[model samples]
Target: MNKTERLLAIVMELQRSKLQTADELAEVLGVSVRTIYRDMMALSEAGVPIIGETGLGYSLMEGYFLPPISFTVDEAVSLLLGTEFIEKRFDPTFRKSARSSRRKIEAILSRPIREETDRIQGSIRLLQKDEMVLMMREKVNLGIIREAMTEDKKLRFTYHKRVAEADGNRVTVRTVSPYGLAHDEQNGWLLLASCDLREDIRHFRVSRMSDLTVTEDTFQTPDNFDLQAYRPKDTRSTQVCAIFNPEIADKVEEANSYYMETAESKEDGYHVTFRVREPEELLSWILGWGADVVVTEPESFINRVREEIGKMKEHY
Candidate 1:
């Protein structure tokens, strides 16, 4: 990366991490330790609110923010795609802000690049599936939950969960201390919270909530609660082995390798294994690939695939 990109990345790194050593930053950004020191000095000179400690490494001061800076075409496109995601799934209040932010980003770029970005943005479209569309229509007020989280207040709500089409569904009341929120392609918006009902941390699909109430009661976030570490670890998952066609190798690793455990070269192609949370979720992904991938898994997964196919045929 060039100096400008590296500088921006340095600022981003400091923002994401409360503290980082020069060695750690060099490893993450793929540069030498000396180069990291030089960049840190340059960023400090440029009035980035970077503070250093003798043994503790460097950090951005609390509440310090980088001013509007230039973005490369790829960076601009990335922001545009994220803004599109927000506009599509979030409430009208947030959607308006997303639109305005995109407009501001475009306004800052030069005309030629702006036109280029517009064309690239035009080629992008997000398909809101029926479930997500329904969620957006009956959307819970995320802003209220956000406020409650800010104030460390408890939230009470009835959550709806459906296990099977024929089995119907269940709604149960829950009081939770909101930790944070995350978005996924599968689950859309999810609220990560510590549930008093479950006596543990649970991920609640925000859209499936009803009769929502932010309580006057407040609680402190556990010092042990780390949102990044809260995600289910692969160590606790079942191992799934597969052979993937080489044609989609790059695409698969880039976009679909989150659950992957290990990948090895093979005579025919690449052999891989992923530690997955559930057979159903991983099976859906494998079936989406059709013949491009084949699963050689524990018989349990194979049986699930067979049963799902049987259901599909019976439905048809």
Candidate 2:
């Protein structure tokens, strides 16, 4: 980091804690001990009110406060946009907090920065399309789920699945120990939890949940569970490859199908590979591109594509 940024970081670090040794500060800031000593000298010269004992760590003098920090246009806009997102996607409690936070941020900004941020935000839009109504409907459930997780309590809900069973039942009652919440641009909010029925970890879409309630039962979170590093394993094994016309290769890439594995450009076209649990999973997506794409792998999938095309021809 630049000297100016490092100085600001040092002030923030010291303000947050009671005592910080030069060695500890060096480790935290990823700088050499000598560099830290130099920074300390600079800070002292600048009259930062830092008190350093010979053996003890350095600390800010009690009751001393730093002035408001300056922010660039990009930094201000990023923080403001974050508050806007939380106000839109989160529950009422957090929505109120987000509004308050936005006002506080705006209150602290200089007039010129505030005007520029408003102009930039005016040109940008955050739209959730058809998911807005669903998210609003499930907003209450999000608060309940959060409370359950905070209190280490179990949760009960009726979940709707995307696919139905042989008996044509698409809904089931579930009790789960909530672990974390995840948001995907395409999938909306999902709850990662340990299901009592499945006896394993599962992801349940919040929008597809109903009659959600917190239970009296409680549980402890496993020590190894880390929400940031966790990724659900993909188990789909069936492989299929398709060649796409160069004219629409960029469009195919933009679609970003979950099963898409690889894309290679050849003389004929862009060859795309997909791994799916079933060929049917890829049928509609391949058909969406029409003449722009041609299936070339898995004779079985080729036959299925032909069958679908034949059925389409019958309509014409």
Candidate 3:
């Protein structure tokens, strides 16, 4: 590797341990003691807080970590997976940021580190499907919302919502914020905010938002705001039990991969269970599957499905 790359690797390796001897680092880098000393001097001159003694080798200063080398294997995997997912789903601005972040990470790794990263990349793969793509998009949107939440800023957007009285026309809304974003699997992306005018915790769908702008006006997130408590308590909050044909079990499994429950296989098919705070979302999903899936429980959910199907048939 080049000198800059080698120096970064040394700093990262040193940060991983308490104190490493010069000989150990030299051996790991395939270099001699004198070369190691020269490199150490170069790193120190470059403002790396490397501490050492005559007998001991070196250690990075506490609280001073190499940004690129600091991530654990799990963190690295999450970053890579999240970045790839965003690149596939988001608009140009977010896609560029994700690509840039990945490049910055790759530039900081040594040959060995790069190899380890490659292994992680090979171990996990996002099987691209329509639902997976949508999930990825939601993840990306959630990330943006989370960032805005952390900054405690207002977001301005033109929101589109269904207007049942007006032949399904979408109404536009301009909203501000009091807090961050929360993911409602049943509702897609939701921003928990006090509307600019209402000053109440209203949920706005991320997909319905356009021309989003994070404002400089900061607001305090209410300490009492709890997403779990705010959830709908009607039968809509009930758990859904479904069975999928074995032939399409894998696809079905991928669809609900983010849920808190597990899927088990039976002689007939695969049984999956999950909770939804809104039945409309689940109903839409089940209808999308046509006949490959069956809703096995929650009589209310079945009735809702029947009602929705009747509405659709009337329209046809």
Candidate 4:
């Protein structure tokens, strides 16, 4: 059990009993006496009114109880939304715990509040397909990646890079010190880490990787490693324009860059303008759309695409 669950359990145990010794509490909770002592200290710090005597043991202060916590309408709705997202987005342990917690929250909510929350939930929805599927279908274990990140350990994986050529992708083995995970609007969950092969920071699409294994070796994050700084930035941003297939109009909005204004639709499809990232990155995205999309402005971007296509043809 995690610290949160243990703390809740401790409170419940105390509420039901008159007085409990540290040894008795430790035995019942399946934790060490030292842990119980630490928990008691923590509870006291949180103003739990846990009174202890030299010989008598521990008990709640007479007539004192753990106070009821309350949430405002917006706060409750926001929590429900988060719970729903976690239950849908995550798998296994995370999903299970979130489901249980959601149920607990629902049980405590007043009827009127619960009804409003239900209405809000019904109105909001996320998809497993479209953009989400690109990241959701991870051939690798997410838990393993999480463990590696948490332990600050090294990871070795066979990464499949999405190649432009008809010959398909090039697979390579990479061993890197795990730094953090980033979820890109276009790419899904990306592992941002120090790459030993490249001798620099690189982001790998977690869904595009396979044969992941955590190493016993530990690593220290660089002192200068700031995620915001690690991403390349240009003083002047590129104005990227593209047309999406009307069938996947939602995806146009999904791919909107941070600097992009709202996507506008013509009769054909959604017209997207992104004050986008570097030229190379934008080119890759346009190519990924294949025949379904086309770039309009920036004659320079059009020429680069033509050049890249020629190279791809040469490769084949």
> Cα lDDT for residue 21, model 1?
98
Q: In angstroms, what RMSD does candidate 4 have relative to the true structure?
A: 10.4
Using alpha carbons, what is the TM-score of model 2? Answer: 0.70
* lDDT (Cα, tens digit) per residue for candidate 1, span 229-305: 78742333678888889887776786655567788768787788888656554776777777788788878887887
Q: Which tens-of-lDDT digit does each residue in 57-161 have in candidate 2?
A: 899887675538677889989999999988888888888889757755764556577689889999999985555675655577789999999999999999987
TM-score of each: 0.54, 0.70, 0.47, 0.57
> Comparing candidate 3 with candidate 4, which one achieves the higher lDDT?
4
Model 4, span 169-237: residue lDDT tens: 378889999887776656667788888988877788888778889999899998988876677434336
* Sort by lDDT, top down from the best: 2, 1, 4, 3
At residue 141, give the lDDT of candidate 1. 54
Q: What TM-score, to 2 decimals, does candidate 4 have?
A: 0.57
lDDT of 2: 0.85
Question: Ten residues in a row with the worst lDDT in model 4?
Answer: 131-140
Alpha-carbon RMSD, candidate 2? 13.9
Clashing pairs in 4: none
Instruction: Give the clash count for each candidate.
Output: 0, 0, 0, 0
The runs of at least 3 residues in candidate 4 whose Cα sits more than 4 Å from the true structure, single-residue gaps closed, are 1-67, 130-136, 164-169, 226-316
Error of 3 at 110 (Å): 2.2
Each model's lDDT comes to: 0.77, 0.85, 0.70, 0.74
Q: Which ten residues in a row have the lowest lDDT in candidate 2?
A: 129-138
